[model samples]
Each structure stands twice: as structure tokens, then as C-alpha cells.
Target: MQRQTTIKKDVSYRGIGLHSGREVSMRLLPAPADTGIVFVRTDAGGRQIHARAANVTSTLRATTVEENGVKVFTIEHLMSALHAHRIDNVCVELNAEEPPVADGSSLAYFDLIESAGIEELRSERHEIVIDRVCRIDDEATGRFVMALPYDGFRVSFISLNPHKLIGTQYEDFHIDAQTYRREIAPARTIAYEKEIDQLREMGLGLGGSLENVIVYNDEGWINPLHFADELVRHKILDVIGDLRLAGIIRGHVIAAASGHALNTALAKQIAASLG
Candidate 1:
């Protein structure tokens, strides 16, 4: 068992959202033990929404949590950072519905949290131990995520893409804050050139650009690859963020072709089972 943790002081940042294209500002404040991570919407008259699986309302292209019609989207990156940092409680105050894209990776958020400094709380974390095999699969897409009993946290992922340039990528990660920051935090979000128009039509990817997003096409990658397996690593990053909604779980997760939807599905299942 480990003590819960929150930042020692308030830290703030401002940028634009990838999907919403809105200018937003956010602050991270320390919270008491067992508060978990809460999203406080300052623009919504100080509405509070807990970051948990039960509150998840959407996973279209990004993980979104909602309560009483108040929604927060594109939280995976920041949540990924929090998960990696093992932060158990914090009040995230945001002036917009979504956080900034932040170079299309978790690096910025990780740095912001580092600046705030983590403080251990008195109470131990309410850990949800995965004692048996738990699995969720999307048959049609061949997407699946599973968790098995393990002494510590780990993630093994496989990313599959129809494109020849990005056919299949695999990576097994033993997660730690240092490893996550160095190996996973810099891996940027990726999109194909072919899907840009479609995404825009769906009112998504409005703030994505060559600067923050790694755009690829059949011709080739428009940007250089940070790691040939960057996509799969980012997918693992998403898994960590999404599964953390179930609280701390002692498990080794194995996933393939999984996305926000499937990740949150597994989170919901684990959370429900624990309750």
C-alpha cells in the first residue's frame, strides 16, 4: 500500500485545445487525501466533476467525463501524466471544457505537475487490486484490453494500422515515473492526412497542426518519427490514463488495437466489480 498524493502548491498553464480550438487556462491545486482527482470548472460556475469511470460520457476520439451536463474532454494526456506521477488527489481548475493539446503529448502536463511538487497524504490509496483475469474486447474491430494480477503496474500494447508505413507496432513497458517521462511522455499524438477533413467535418481536430500533431499519409510521414513505435506507446499512455479512473490497480495490462472507448470500458468494468 502507498500513501495518496497531491501537489504541494498551485500551478497554472494556458494554451489551445486540439479539438475545441478554444483558448483555455487551467490550474492544479493540492487536495486532501482521498479526494481523488476532481475537475473543477471555473467557467461553469464552479461545477465539480470527479475523474472516475462512472462519470465517463464519451470516448469518441478522446476520453470525456461528464456530470449534470458539464463535460470535460481531451483529458487523457493530463490524466496520463497524473497516473505516471502516481498522483491520487488534486483539484484541476479549468476555464474551458478541455485542456490544451500541449505539443500533442503528456510532456507539458508532466512538467507542470513536477513544478507544483507532489506531497504525500496521510491516508493510504484505495487500491483496486486485480486478483483475476479481466478482459474486454471489441469483436468487430478486434480491439481488446485485459488485466491480470501483478505485483506492480505494467502495460504491454500493440498498435495496428492498415497503412503500410505503420503496419504493426508493439511495446512492453514496466511503468515508472522516470521511464514514463523519458520513454512515453514525448511521444506525440498522430493522425493521418487522409482523415483531417473528416475530423474537421465532425468538429474535431480543429487545433491540430504540424507543430503539435504528427501527420502521416500513404506518401510518408510529414513529420519525423520520435520512435518507430510511438503510436503504440501513446496508446499505452492512453490506457494508463483511462484505467486510472478505476483508481490504483495492481495489475499487468495487455492490450491490442485498443482506443479510448475500449480502455474506458475496461475501467468501468473494474470499477463496478470493485464496488
Candidate 2:
């Protein structure tokens, strides 16, 4: 049986929130077995929000979880790192509403967790294994996500954009610690140049920069890409993190042009189907 795991020591970081544009400090602390991942709002009245789909309050541009009037924002990257490391229990303490952007990828979080090391618990890890095909589709938006029974976690993703700079792209990979760190963790979040002003006007992407995000224009990528299909790879990375909201899932996930909304929706469906 797979053992539940948590970090051996505390790991901390400081950075700016992608949308909030506020400086924040966060620390990941090891927790007891079966604790799962929980976010502690240190700035609030110590509100605790379990990192699960049931607590998710918003998926607009980023994932946010709220409990008792306290909300945590843009947590997908950190969540993805914990999931990749197979960390079943952790308490993420933060002094702000969001975690640091940290190059807009999970790479920094992965490194921090690796440095802290993983400790196995006496309890065995449990996962919600998909027994049948489950799907979530947005016909109007042309977005789709589905899960199928599989022995281990895997993700296949496709990104389709009208912009020539970010045309159709596809990638598939099995979810393992090494593979995730090398391939998916470093894939930075992506956005369109044309949408920058719109996003800022909507009070989002204020902390975004070329250093942390892959900006694409009608011409091409504003910043260098780590992989040719890094955009699609990042999409898969987000899916991996979002699905963790359902706890560990032993299944294969396939997504097309899906973002946080659809990703979390699929997670809710899988969680509800669990028996």
C-alpha cells in the first residue's frame, strides 16, 4: 500500500500575488497523516480552509477557496506541487489572500518541498479511483474534460486558440514525481498580450510580468518558452493541481481548451461519484 506523506520540515517563500499585487509570505508546514492539504489565513482570525472542491469559491482566472469570510486566491500552482510530491498532509500558512506567483509555475514550490524532504506516515494513502468514464463539457465554450479508469494518474491536454501565435497544441504525459518536475513544473503560466489591459482593467494580472508568464502576441511569444508546447503542458499542470481538490485520483484525465472552471467542475463530479 502507498503510504501517506508530508514534509519533514517547514519551507517558506515570499512573493507578490498575481492578481492582488500584494506582497505575501507563505510557509508550508508538515501535518499529521490524513490531514490532507489545508490553508490557514494567518492574517484572518486563523480561518482554516480545506483545499477541496467543496470549499472552492471561485475559478475566475485562478482558483480561490473561502471559508468563514476568509478567502485564499491563486492556489493552483502550490496545490499542483503538493500533489506531484504526493504530499497527503500539509498546512499552508499565509499572511495574505494569495501565495506568491514564484515565476508563475510550480517549479519553485516543487524545489522548496523537495528541499524539505518527504516523510511517510504510518497510515496508508487512499485515492478515489475512477470506475467509469466521467466527463464535463461546455458546448458553448468548446471546452471539455474527462476522466477514465487507470492504474495511475495521467493527463492529456490540448490548447486551441484563434491567435496564430498560440495555435492548436497538444501534449500527453504520465504523472510521476520526476516527470512532473522536469516537464510540467517549469511550464510557466501563459496569457495573450491583447488581454493584458483587459485583465488589468478587470482587477487581475496586476503582478504578472514577462518574467513569470509566457506572453504571446499576434506575432509570437514575448518571452522564450521552455518547451515548444509549453502552453499545453501548463494546462496539464493546472489540471493536475485542480484535480487534487478531489483528493488523490487514480485515473487518466483528458482535457481540451479547459481552464480552472472546467477543471474544478470535473473534480467535483469525480468526488461526487466516489463510492
Candidate 3:
């Protein structure tokens, strides 16, 4: 049987928050078996918020979790890294309201977790395996996500934009630790040139730069593309992270034109169905 896992030692990362534009430091510490992933707001009297769909308060541009009026924002990337590494229990301590948006991808977080090392626990791991198909759709946005029975975890994603730079794209992957680290973790988040102004006006993406996020112009990417289908691959990364809110999911997920809102909605439904 597979066993639960946590970091071997404490690891830390420092960077700027994507939306807040404030420098923040976060530390990941090992936790006991069955602890799950818990975020502790050190600046807020050590408030503990479990990384679960029920605690999610916002999914506007990024995922945010709240407990007792205390909030933590932009956590999907880090959470995705933990999930990719098969870390079942971890204590994430943050002094600010959000973790740094390092490189705008899970790659940095993955490196930090790797440096800290992973230790398997004595307890066996458990996952919420979908026995039947579960699906969510947003008619207005033409977004949809579905979970189907599978022997293991996998994700299939499709992205479409009216912009010529990023037209229709599709990707599918059977997610495993090695595949996640190599293919999914390095795919950076993307934003369009036209939307940059509006995002800045809304006080979001303040720390975003061409170095971190893939900027697509009318012609093509401002930076060299990591993969031919990097946009869809990044969508898969976000889906992996969002699904972590329901704990480790063992199934195949298919998504079309889905974003944070649809991801969290489907996560809530999946979590509820398991209960």
C-alpha cells in the first residue's frame, strides 16, 4: 500500500506576491501523518486554515482560503507542488496574507519541496476515488469539467481564446510524480497583452513580469514558449492544484475552457460527493 508523506525538514521561499506586490516569506514544515496540508498565518495569531474546498473564500483570479475572517491568497501553485510531490501532510507557515508568486509556476515550489526532501509516513495513504462520472458546467462561460473513473490520476485540458496568439489548444497527461515535475510544474501561468492593463488597474498581477508569466501578444508569445502547448499544460497544472482541495483524487479529469472559478466549483462538488 502507498504511504502518507511529508517533508523531511523545514524549507523556506521568499518572493513577491502576484497581487499584493508585497515581499513575503513562507516556510514549509513537516507534519504528522493524517495532518493534511494546513496553512498557518503567523501574523494573525497563528490562525490555522486547512487547505480544503470548504475553506475557499475567493476564486476571482486566484484561489484564496479563509478561516475566522483571516485570509490567505494565491495558494494554488504551492498547493499544486505539494500535491505533485505526494506530500500528504505539511505545515505551511506564512507571515503575510499570501505566498510569494515565485516564477509564476509551481516549479519553484517544487524545487523547495525537493530540497526539503520527502519522508514516507507509517500510515497508509488514502484517496477519494471517483466511482462514477461527475461533471460541472457553466453555460454562460461555456466552461465545463468532469471527473471520470480511472485507476490512477490523470488530466486532460483544452484552452481557447479569441486572440490569434492563443487559439484552441488541447493536452492530456497521465499524472505521476515524475511526469508532474518534468511537464506540468514548469508550465508558467499565462496572461494576454490586452488584459495586462485591466489586471493592473484591478491591483492584480502587480508582481507579474515577462520573466515570470507568459505574455501573449497579438502575434505570439513575448517570451519563448516552453512547450508548443504550454497554455493547455498550464491549465492542467492549475487543475491539479485546484483538485488538491478535495485531497488526493484518483480519477481522470477532463476540462474545457475552465479557470479558477470552475475548478473550485468542481472541487467542492467532488469533495461533497466523497463525503
Candidate 4:
């Protein structure tokens, strides 16, 4: 049987939160088997929020989970890292309302887990295997997310944008720890030049910069690209992180222009189908 696993020791990091723009410190600690991924807000008197689709309250620019009036922001990247590593149980303690946006990608968190090492638990791990095709769509935007039966976790995404620099980009990943670290983890968040001011007016993306966030304009890209099709790869990365809330999914996720809303909705759908 596949055993649940978590970090072997404590590890910590601090950085700027993408939306809140405040410094947030997080500590990853080993948890008892079957604990799943749990987040506790140290600043909010130890209010705990279980990382699950049902707890998600917002999917604006980032994924937000709330419990007992406490909200945690921008969790997808770290969650994706945990999923890639097959970490089934861990206690994440945060000093603020959000986890830091280190490098605006999962690479930093992945490295942190690597440094801490993984420990297998005696408890058996449970997987939500897709037996049939399931789909969710954003009718207005024509974006959709779906899952199909596969032997391993895989994600195929097609990023559709109207901009001249980024029109249509597509990529699929057979997700594994190594593939994630090398391909998806390093792909940073994307921001259009025109959206910065609007995002600021809404009090979002305050910590975003050319360094952590890749900016593009009508003229051209303001920053360098890691891969020619990095945008589509990052979309796949987000899907991995968001769907992870349901547990280790043993299937293939196929998507097009799907963001947080469709991602979490599919997660909830898959969770509900589990017996």
C-alpha cells in the first residue's frame, strides 16, 4: 500500500505576499498520519483552516481559503509543491494571512521541501482515481476544466490570450516530482502591462514585479521567459495546486483557459464523487 508522507523536520521561510504585499512567514512541520495539509494562522490566535475545496471562499486573483473568519491567501503555489512531492500530511503555520510569494512560483517551496526531506507514515494513502471523464466550464469565457482516467497524475492546458505576444499556447505535463521541479515549478506568474494599475486600484498584485512576475506589454515582454511556452506550463502548475485540495488525484486533467474558479470547482466535483 502507498503510505502517507510529510516532511521529516521543520523548515521555514518568509517573503512578500503577492496580493497583500506584507511579509509573511511560514513554517512547515511534520504532522501525524492522515492529518492532510492543514494551515494555522499564528497571527489570528492559532485559527486553523484545513486545506480543502469546501473551505475555499475566494478565487479572485489567487486562491483563498477561510475558516472561522480567518482567511489564507495565495496558496496554490505551495500546495502544488506539496502535491508534487506527494506530501500527504503537514502542518503549515503562518504568521500572516497569506503565504509568501517567493519567486512567484512553486520552485522555492519545492526546494524547501527537498531540504527538509520526506518521511513516510504508517498510514495508507488514499487516492481519488478518475474512472470517467468529468468537466466544468465557465460559459461566459468559454474556458473549461476536465478530468479523465489515467494511470498517473497528468495535466494538459491550453492558454488562450488575445495579446499579440501571447495568443495561443498549449502544453501537457505528466506530473512527477522531477518534472514539476524542472518544468512547472520555475514558471512564474504572468501579468500584463495594462493590468497593473487596475490591480493596484483593487489592492492586488502590490508585491508583483518584473523579478517575481513576468510582465508583458503590447510591444513585447518586459522580462525574460524561462520557456517559450511558460504561460501554458504555469496554468498546468496552478491546476495541480488547486486540485490537490481533493487529495492525490490519480488521473489526467485537461483544461483550456481555466483559472482558479474552474480549478477549484473541478476539485470539489471530484471530491464529491469519491465514496
Q: What lDDT score goes with residue 230 in model 4?
A: 84
Candidate numbers, best TM-score first, in rank order: 4, 1, 2, 3
Clashing pairs in 2: none
Off by over 4 Å in 3: none
lDDT string for model 4 (98-186, tens) is 89998888999999999999998898899789999879988888899999999998898999998888899999889999999999999
Model 4 TM-score on a 0 to 1 scale: 0.98
Candidate 1: where is the Cα deviation over 4 Å? Answer: none
List runs of model 2 lying over 4 Å from the truth. none
lDDT of 2: 0.91
Clashing pairs in 3: none
lDDT on C-alpha atoms for all candidate structures: 0.92, 0.91, 0.90, 0.92
- In candidate 3, position 32 carries an lDDT of 99
Q: Which has the higher lDDT value, candidate number 2 or candidate number 3? A: 2
* Regions of model 4 farther than 4 Å from truth: none
TM-score of 2: 0.98
lDDT at 221 for candidate 1? 93
Model 3 is weakest, by summed lDDT over 10 consecutive residues, at 158-167
What tens-digit string does per-residue lDDT give for candidate 1 at 181-268? 9899999999999999999999999999988899998899999988888888889889999998998777899999999999999999
Give the clashing residue pairs of candidate 4, or none: none
